[model samples]
Target: MMKTALHSVSYAGVWPGQARLGLDDFLERTRNLGFDAVMLMAKRPHLSLLDYDADARSRLRQRLAGLGLKVACLAGYTDFCLGAERPDIPTRELQILYVRELARLARDLDCGLVRVFTGFDYANVSLDQQWGWCVTSLRECARQAADAGVNIGIQNHHDAAVHYESLFELVEEINEPNCKIMFDAWSHAPVEKAASAGFRQEGGDLVAAVKKLAPYLVHTTVADYVHRPRYRYQPNLINYICESDALRAVPLGEGFIDYKSFFKALKEIGFDGYVAYEMCSYLRGGGSEENLDGYARKFLDYLSAF
Candidate 1:
């Protein structure tokens, strides 16, 4: 990653769900990784809570300044329970309020993005209701985040509203400069008109999906993937790119993302954001800290190709 210094956020591992390391160890490790920044996955011990605040919060803040690591984004998975399956309005509103609290903490730490989501309808609700609720929610969040000078990012999760076309529509509907699609290359290829019409694979170019998405990609994250043998690539790297089912994390550049195309579009859009190296399988098998560190380094190196 020395060839390409990037501000990054890691979700595949590090500061994970129910991590036993607490905040100090997490920040200390992130600083040691030579990562300029870190994104706290705010599931538990969210740095905003003052009570029972693990000394880790204060300690992590000190370590960040001491180590010169920038807190980049506070990655949170939040919504208004707009989905029919989990329609809990009061609870989701409270969660968003909690996220705002986290944003205040992030501002104190000098981070940038508070990555959240548009509630899922990936394949469920009627497009009208889905887009309506999604647009309204994002616009409000954007207004709030803008007032706070924090950008709100909508993660492209694959449930309903986040499907390629659906998301494009949502972004267009919201039309908030503060709200943007945090393009995740691992998500589904944009649904082609032909595909939506049920004749896509017949002749539609899959690469077009990335083109369709690039327009709204205000934030970019670069990862690794390998192409299929059919592509005739060297080292078996850069073979294919696709999403993962296990933990929903894809190894960087191993699927069909077409980074060349992605990078081209990114440049066109002028995306100057975190290229989070969020690769998976790096922390499996109870690897030693040194092993994980080395693995992280190598992945970082691989990511420098862009």
Candidate 2:
């Protein structure tokens, strides 16, 4: 059975000009929304290591117990090769330490997973070198998490392992029992550039990607979005032309993504982990507490039906 979870980023108001709800409020809101668990943003205004000490962790655990909520995972923001821009920066070490501390907190909170990311590509570094850095750093992170009895999920949200094959290679390279893919339909969608990265031989085939990567999937974060074509006006030419597609978040099953196929694949593969919902970006309805709660419930109902 797949458990439903809500990411607190939906309520953190991290985006500018959005409603700011504290973590405690977010927890209570999630419980009211009827989720099985929650995936907390492991940063400020939430569960930052600097803010969460031993006593704080204890208090948080008690609060969750009272609310009947479980910490599904901790979302750790990291860019392993970000320091490549300036050799003096110890970004790799800092990120590793960050994950280590999150792992400790996960243990204290009785959570089993911490979600992490690879680095974006840097102009100053070769792609392969960036890949090597991520592999090495992720190995250390996996070791640290394993020591704390927590699992680390590598989300395909960064350039280093954005493609399905690249992400699979990353898992094989790390070869840690605790390291697994937090796969989602968005990244697995084969687009024009997927050939070079090996997402799928055929493009725009998300179901294939899900089926292919099913064995290594431990968690998945989901949100739906509609693509509005971006048009630019050339006043001199008196013509408007399409530039790109502006993705706007919508209630589940209302976007361009074929989530039915994606979820179907997960079910076919017997994926029994958390299916997390998030509104981490600009939402269709403005970010009000009522709107956020409404969207979260929409997602909950969608997952229940799915």
Candidate 3:
């Protein structure tokens, strides 16, 4: 389908503490919230290895089928390289083997997208050496993933991080159309020229970042927002796009992000993927259904325009 879709809000936007309900409970509520599909997170609460076990695997598949929710992408977070401590042949080979195996499993699960991580640059580390390891690892991952009919979704996270240009460089050099990047809006917003429409800054814009990175835009996130006491900007339980507004982040649309063009760009690029509302809200500590439903409806309407 050329049209983009929304993953079930049941997917953890982050880790363990974020959820108030159990997995099954959340999935039911998420369906009621109107999400069309669901994207699993790469970390705890929804481990990547869940794709391997037959029982756990079968149960997940059956549940989604029963609920009519499609599996959009597996949000896995593994560093392709284990670092120079394992610079030698055997260690490196083992690392590659494990990930390749995981990629194969993801393919078997019919999850075409797997989001891996780019490690942060360390102090005193030479750019060439660090990047050399990263580049080699990603290319190998891409090759194996391609063989498995799966694509790598390189996710963005700051600190010992991979800069936007570096990510672009990696994808371009690898030259595998399937090797894509998952731009976490929080990480992505600052890296690009800030969208001039609503926010101003010497900092980069979210619009420009997404545009420059659009060719490889594998997944995107959204959320609800509200003003915070600090007041420079709102902070939700999580804000997928910014830290500057406050140490506390807000939900989608409730913050400074203008997703009109963000959604438009996906449709323009023919991204047949889910526009997940990354949970920076987590049901806002148990608010009214009217509140959650209103946000979901409004956001869905906003996205459907494109």
Top candidate, metric TM-score: 2
Deviation from native of the Cα of residue 44 in model 3, angstroms: 3.6
> How far is 197's C-alpha from truth in model 2 (Å)?
16
Any idea what lDDT model 2 has? 0.86
Which of the two candidates, 1 or 2, achieves a greater lDDT against the reference? 2
Instruction: Output the better candidate (1/2) by TM-score.
Output: 2
**Which portions of model 3 miss their true places by more than 4 Å?**
1-17, 20-22, 80-95, 158-163, 192-204, 223-245, 280-298
Ranking by lDDT: 2, 3, 1
What shift in Å separates residue 110 of candidate 1 from its native position after superposition?
Answer: 1.3
Q: After superposition, how far is residue 142 of candidate 1 from its true place, in Å?
A: 1.5
- Candidate 1 root-mean-square deviation in Å: 7.8
Best by lDDT: 2
> Any residue pairs clashing in model 2, and if so which?
none
lDDT of 1 by residue, 214-279 (tens): 666655555543322233345568565443223322344444456666665555655566666553
lDDT tens readout by residue for model 3, 121-155 = 66556767666766677778788888888888777
lDDT winner between 1 and 3, please give it. 3
> Candidate 2, after superposition: displacement of residue 93 in Å?
0.7
Every candidate's CA RMSD: 7.8, 2.5, 6.7
Quantify all predictions' global Cα lDDT against the true fold. 0.58, 0.86, 0.61
